[model samples]
Target: MLAFPRPASSAFYRPDIDGLRAIAVLSVIAYHIGVPGLPGGFVGVDIFFVLSGFLISGLLRQELLATGSLGFAAFFARRIRRLGPALMLVTLVTLLAGYMVLLPDAANTLGREARAVVTLSANHHFMKHAFDYFNTATDLKPLLHTWSLAVEEQYYLLWPLLMLGAYRAGGGEKALRPTLLAVLLLSFAACLSLSYSDMPKAFYLMPARAWEFAAGGLLAWLPLRHSRSAWHANALAGGGLAILLCSIVLLDEHSMVFPGWVVLLPVCGTLLVLAAGGLDPHHAPGRLLGSRWFTALGLLSYSWYLWHQPLLALGRYYDVGQRDLLRDFLLGGVLALFLAWLTYCLVEQPVRQRRWRCFATDKSTLWAGLAMSVLVWLVASAAMYMPKKYPWPGYQAILQVKQDQAQLPPGCDMPERGVPLSPQASCRIGPAHAPLQLLAWGDSHTDHAMPMYQLLAQAQGVGILRRAYHGCPPLVDAVPVGEGKVRSWCLNHSRAVMAELASLSRSGLHGVLMNVRWNGYTALPVAGSASITGLAQADAQGNVAVAGAMLAGVGQLDRAHSLQVMAASLDRVASQLAALRLKLVLLAPEPEMPLSVPECLARRGAAACHASRADVDRQRAAILPILQQVASRHANVRVWDPIARFCDAQTCYAAAAGVVRYQDQNHLTASMSRTLQADFAPLFSWARQP
Candidate 1:
């Protein structure tokens, strides 16, 4: 245990610290509003955490040294008075605004977040939601910023008790310092470990973040004599500010390692600033921080933090394209400042100053805080369950139609690697005892057609094996590129499905239906190396004679040649299946809508819920020619066009007969798939024959 000299008073008012607060809050606001220069402005939260730990620990240490005891009730009462009123006001206003602007699903999510905020469990809630703090979607969440406040509150809830225990156990402040240092080291280690494996845990949990606070607390507990040399103070503060500015400018959302070792930059910088100011108030850095503008901004910082997010979120909600982003951000900032001033003067100051006699006593303040929390929770709950009335008639029915889309059938399952594909039975639809007549192979597009296939199989007394992997194309040689790298799982799954198809073909499977989102394979770059266009260009330049060698037997090709070889691989597979006397049918791409069917119908009327035929034709042109060329080379292969079922001369219907055709933008709803039975009758009729 280390010993230290106690300071004169627990509460030391520092205008410089308030200026630091102004810097912290402004950086956060600038980052949230998408300011161009400060991509890493989120480090402001780290500054706040350090400041909080220093102030609170210093106050507690002084009380213990002066009174030789802790007043738990009085301390909690002060916290409630300071935090409760402003929090409740912001939450109420945000909730009301959210109800008016947000969709039903988004509104329901807000209500759940509100409940979590009231109980100081918002961090846990957001973690469960798998929220990425730096993602674009986070901008729409009005209460997302409250997670930091929750972390601070949760820390305060238990930190004082722990300090009191340590004070009694060790008999002085000296003994507590080493214990806090050990805890800080351990927490930082945890943060590093979890950040790599489980980012949400490291990002949102208090334990992983406790080291930052403990760093501040340990600084407060240490004995530091005021530096008589003004040069030392100036250098320390100036260097700290420089580090903070660099962190704000250099990092971004795309940086993989964050809130880990990288966080040391901002945390250490903040510590330096605090230390320098504590040592010399009249130093160059200290004098600048204590200036009038910085001090006033610091006074309003708390309220400003509370108001900024909601205003920005609402602004984004109303302005879809964010036309003139700079103007919108400026307007939002101005509104936030106005609201922050109002709340600070009207609510925060009054409550903290005990202007309301009802909350004059500690017990009364606690009760009042709890009562307000309960009222907010009730309002949030009401908002969540409030009857949602859509502007368009029959919208409820369209939603119901989407909901009725069946899940993956009982015997059909696609588990991740190392898991059994299916447990109780084979991936077969129709009669259990019947022989396998048809095999559906592709990606999720095949999964979407399962209900229709099941109906067809039962009517024709034929067993169908549904073998599909989500997002894995049926092509033998191609791999998916996601997040700028080849998806190994997609490659592995494709090989596995192709092996299964070969085995099933040898067992006398009558036919195979290849159903995939063909456009995805053609347009998306393959394995992050080359796209279909690049492949075609290579062939055109005589670098890789893909078209000339279309009928050549399979051979080992360079990895860069994989995407270019996909069309040839499809033709080769078709030829092999044809040799085995099995039929091959390729389902043409469906007309994908630009937006979800429900969103389109609700935003625009049902009469406007159709896509232009020319757009669909243009999008499918590249893939259609490839499919046609493959079919032309094999006698057993045939192409099935579903466009005639949905499109007229100039338009493709998204909804018909009062039913939505799509569950989302691209996939067909089960209800809509079932309605395609007439078009599918011929395939079943062909299978039913001897």
Candidate 2:
């Protein structure tokens, strides 16, 4: 085993250590860029963690031993001096970019993300969006990099107290070693466990990250001093460097996690290199790290890290062409280094030398920067509070995102929607005690099809009752797999609705109308998880599990559902209506508008970009089949597809011939659904004639 020896000096800043910094940061930048033979370059941050823990703990330990107490104010002041300026600058840049580039929906998300970044809660923001990544829009927020700063901020808040308590409770410098060792062991155990149980959470947050810092703490507290043989130093340095290289160049996919036990390769490798610091100058790799060039990059590592991500991210965002990705990555890398050199040589050195001393070290200055960050975050959040009103440019691209987010039909989620009031609880859609009772029951898709039903009811002179939820499909015969608990609740609820409908039908209710996202029943496991629900037999990774309920993932990707359950339910409802001699007319699914009515207006007004023909075709095919089937079967059932009114060979406009067609993806905005039905009112008018 090797050990790290600390000399009794607070100012022992080593240039060779800075060279090691070059190794760690370059590895991370390389891995993110997907450079050849460097798939595991991310592990380099682990190496940095170990180095940081050892170095910072070493400084704090020396401070405590000499002064008998930690300078809490001074420590935080130093941190502010080091981090606050750059962070504030970056947040401003991010907010400015968000305002200029993102759509209203996307900008609203950026606003939410800005608060997370300012508050250091970005890890939580991403975790919540994890399950919704496919249909949900991906990150457009520029401040995403602040997740690391949040981790660091959390660490700074809690770590000093822990160290102070350990030192004071031990009563002397001698007790420091044992206390740190114990803490390291315990923290490492927890980190190891989290690496297995909940890797994503562990990887994203700073809790598991504490152990990487602890590893460095352990090295700083080692009992023995450095004593490396020439042969040993060469062999050990070579072996450790090999492991570091392996971690940087090879690890890929989702096999292991960062800040976990697997991170030990780079962490321990960094420690091993530290062990050889007192080695013979003849040792090869030591001389390599000792070189002036590597040390310069190491000294500049902090600036390099700050500059790289945003630069590359902006290029990727714009999809800039530069031959192949390698050429683009290299160009980005060169630009990053130039900016890093500028920041270090110009900003960092000048500040450290007290050239800008007044603002640089002042308490009020940090407070001001923090206040500015808070103000930006709050402004962004207020914008999010009503994001649609903002005149953001890219919103047309994300209107589909709003539509794609139309999971389930309507209602039917956690708290329940469109449920009927208890019989004792009176709620009416129209005037009470009308001459004819009209009951409308189904999903939000039913809500969208409502205006047509309303027209028919009006022409026939009857009242309308509505009951439906977004995700709850109309299943009559069999229980859906996947949603064991949910299926039970929904089945009981649907049974209750049908039973109530039975009473009304028997009571001589004039008509019964129903509608649903029918393809909601046939979701395939592969390409269709977003469109349909409760039926995807397998997931995106080919695992057998139903994904969310949406229109995109309808029917089967593999094994088939005759969907006998849904078909039977429709037949049963139809038979009931026929028996009651109620006028029964089913709407053939209306063709989906390529854009929501609002988005179409924006594009026409030159406020947004239009979607591709491919998007329209994909949506059009989604509901075509069920619409055809409902029209052909029951003689009393009438299907109505308004494709003729809104679509042409060239395109399907969200609004056509002055008719505003949709509120959102499929639900009619209450106003648009009601008003637009006037043109299609004749079909319902004809259907209800006795």
Estimate the TM-score of every prediction: 0.72, 0.64
lDDT per residue (tens digit) for residues 1-690 in model 2: 111212123345555577688898888777555577877876767777788788878888889988989988777766666666555555556556656554566567767877787677776676454322212122223445456667667876877787888778878777777767776677677776755544445655677677777778777766534455688777767887888887776665333343456677887788877766645444678779867778777867777777666655544444311123564476347777777777766666655544774545557556655775678677767756554666555665535434432222232332342234344123223334554465656666776766555555555565566655455655433334421112344454565666676676666565555566555454433121332244432222323333222222333321245244345556665665666566554554444443344544553441222333455455546455544565566666665665555456755555544544565445554434555466656655544344
Displacement of the residue 580 alpha carbon in candidate 1, Å: 15
Runs of candidate 1 with Cα error greater than 4 angstroms are: 1-11, 314-332, 388-690
Which 10 consecutive residues of model 2 have the lowest summed lDDT?
Answer: 1-10
Q: Pick by lDDT: which candidate is best?
A: 1
lDDT of each: 0.74, 0.57
Which residue window of length 10 is worst by lDDT in model 1? 548-557
Report the C-alpha lDDT of model 1 over 1-690, residue by residue, as the tens digit.
111211123245777788889899989998888788899999999999999988888888899888877899899899899889999999998888877766566677888899999999999887766345765556667888989988989888888888888888888776678778877899899998877555667888999998899999888888877898988889989999998888888877554456768899889999999889878877888888888788778888898999988888767754431324576576557888878888887887778778888578999998998998998999899767662544123446545655757466565666665134453246777877877878887888898887788788877787877778776676544454322223345545555665665776777577887888765554332211112222221221223333211211112222234435567767866877776677878888888875557656666666666788998897677777778888898877778888988899998888887668887567888888888877977965564333
Query: Best by TM-score, which number?
Result: 1
lDDT of 2: 0.57
